[model samples]
Target: MDVLYFAWVRERIGLPKEKVESQAATVNDLVAELSAREDRYAAAFADLSALRVALDQELSDFDASLAGVREVAFFPPMTGG
Candidate 1:
């Protein structure tokens, strides 16, 4: 899957996007796997409540299924000016 990071998430993970190979069934599972990989990933996913997720560009939740998903993006919630 292609995992993308935006805003501060890219800053923390040090990459805007990367291909990931995993057996995760859900978004939260993927997060746990990444968080276990390094301190940077852990910091990037420190608070799920502070972040938002997208599956193939569609807004999704951490518990959302990853079936047939080709892309996943993580970013902070947007604010209106």
Candidate 2:
């Protein structure tokens, strides 16, 4: 899957996106896997409440299924003025 990070998530991870190979069944599982890989990933996903997720561009929850999903994006909740 292609994992994408936006805004502060990207800043923390030090990259915009990357292809990941995993056996995760949900977004949260994927996060745990990434978080185990490094401190940067841990920091990026430290607080799930501070972030939002998308599966193939559609908004999804951390517990959402990852089956058949080709892309996953993580970013902070948006704000408008």
Candidate 3:
């Protein structure tokens, strides 16, 4: 899967995107795996409420299944002026 990070998430993880190999069944599971990898990943995924997720370019919940998903994007909730 191609994992993408945006805004502060990109800053924390130090990458815009990366291909990930995992056995995670859900978005939350993927997050736990990444968080266990390093401090940067932990910091970026520390508070799930502060962030939003997209699966294959569509908004999704953290508990959403990752089956057949080719892309996952993480970013903070957007605000418009």
Candidate 4:
């Protein structure tokens, strides 16, 4: 799957996107896997509540299924003035 990072997430992870080989069943599972990889990943995914996820370009929750998903994007909630 291609995991994309936006805004500060990209800053923390130091990448805009990357192809990931994961056996995760849900978004949360993927997060845990990434968080365990290194300190940077851990810091990037430290607070789930502060982040928002998108699956294949559609807004999704952390517990959403990852089956058949090709792309996953992580970013902070948007705000409009």
lDDT of 2 at 5: 97
Report the error of model 1 at residue 24, Å.
0.1
Instruction: Estimate the TM-score of every prediction.
Output: 0.96, 0.97, 0.96, 0.96
The TM-score measured for candidate 3 stands at 0.96
Cα lDDT listed for each candidate:
0.98, 0.97, 0.97, 0.97
lDDT of 2 by residue, 1-81 (tens): 999999999999999999999999999999999999999999999999999999999999999999999999999998868
What's the TM for model 1? 0.96
What is the overall TM-score of model 4 with all chains considered together? 0.96
Worst 10 residues of 3 by lDDT: 72-81
Error of 4 at 29 (Å): 0.4
User: Please, what are the lDDT tens digits per residue for candidate 3 over residues 1-81?
Assistant: 999999999999999999999999999999999999999999999999999999999999999999999999999998869
Off by over 4 Å in 2: none
Candidate 1 stretches greater than 4 Å from native = none
**Candidates' RMSD to native:** 0.9, 0.9, 0.9, 0.9
Clash count of each predicted structure: 0, 0, 0, 0
User: For residues 1-81, could you state the per-residue lDDT of candidate 1 as single tens digits?
Assistant: 999999999999999999999999999999999999999999999999999999999999999999999999999997769
RMSD, model 1, all Cα superposed? 0.9
